[model samples]
Target: MHRLANPTRFLRLCNMVKPWAMAITLLCLATGLYFSLFKSPPDYQQSDTVRIMYVHVPAAWMAMFCYSAMALSSAAALIWGHLVAQLIAKATAPIGASFTFLALITGSLWGKPMWGTWWVWDARLTSVLILFFLYLGFIVLHDAFDDTSRGARAASILAVVGAVNVPIIKFSVDWWNTLHQPASVVKLDGPAIHSSMLVPLLLMACGYTGFYLWMLIVRMRAEFNSNKIRAIRIRQANR
Candidate 1:
């Protein structure tokens, strides 16, 4: 990690990995979509409407996972003054935000058919909503200051603070009486979901994760180039 901390090295590594990551993301998405749309069986209860879980559950997972990554990177930035960590957190924000939005939209879509409502203030839903706001807040705070370093520091603090919500989002169904269903795929005893449904759901989750990595690497490379250009321009202005 330290060896790849240099921006030039990071850019080179990203260039090398980008094509492979993009390929894998596409492949996984294709296979996953086939499994999700064609191969998977409908839920005994919800019927066709349960199909939304493939997209909604994975997006919700990524939303939490991405924010957790950001928080860890932000902590590294604050404690170790790691520029790459800060860049990673910065690069991950919009992607995480998009995942949160997808989760919310798809959850709402799934809800209307299953729950007979488009929205709810249930603990699970509300916590995920708060997660979305945290992402938005991180973006806004990161750009709010004239001094970029100061802004980054402030955003890092917020990221770390907001991280407390991740676990809440994950366990909200268990912790509170809510409209949301409890865990099906991940549980202490074993997966409650049937193998037929679980396989497609797992594939879709992996696809979403790969997609996030592919986008994150691209965004990080662009951000590194933008910073380099800004530095060069500043040097020219000084000269």
Candidate 2:
């Protein structure tokens, strides 16, 4: 871990990882889509509309996963003063926001056909929406100040605080009456979903995770380069 804290060493590791991440992302997404669209049987009740679950459920899962990762990274950055951890938290925000937005849009699309509404203020839906705003807030706060460290600290604080919403989003349906369905795939007894449906869902989830990793490496590399350039400019100016 200490060795990886060095930016050059981290970049070397990322160079090795980026290709594998991209490959896994492509393979999983392709296979998952094929199974989700053709092999898996549609829900008897929702018919063809059930196909939306393949995209929506995985996306919602990724949204929370990414945010949780961001919060943890932020905490690490603050507690240990890890620059790479700070970069990771910064890199993760936009991707997490994208995932959250995707989830909300897909959720609404799925909801329309089943619930007969395009939107709802239910606990699950509302909490996820708050999560989306939290992502945006972090991104904004991180760049709001001219002093970059100050901005980063502010954003990190926000991320750590906003993490409280993750549990709420996850348990919202169980805690309160809501239009959203309760846990079917992550139950204590094990997934209630059939193998046919579960396979593609898991595949898509893996694909999403791979995609995040690929993009995070790319973004972190860019950030490291930018910081290096900025440091050089400051040194030359002083000289």
Q: Compose the digit string of candidate 1's lDDT tens values, residues 57-152.
A: 999999999999999999999998988889999999999999999999999999999999999999999999999999999999999998889999
Looking at model 2, report the run of 10 residues with the lowest lDDT sum.
1-10
- CA shift at 197, candidate 2, in angstroms? 0.7
lDDT of 2 by residue, 145-174 (tens): 999999999999999999999999999999
Instruction: Provide the TM-score for each candidate, comma-separated.
Output: 0.96, 0.97
Give stretches of model 1 more than 4 Å off. none
By summed lDDT, which 10 consecutive residues of candidate 1 come out lowest? Answer: 1-10
Residue pairs in clash, model 1: none
Scored by Cα lDDT, where does model 2 land? Answer: 0.94
What's the distance in Å from true for residue 78, model 1? 0.8
User: Residue 72 CA error for candidate 2 (Å)?
Assistant: 0.6
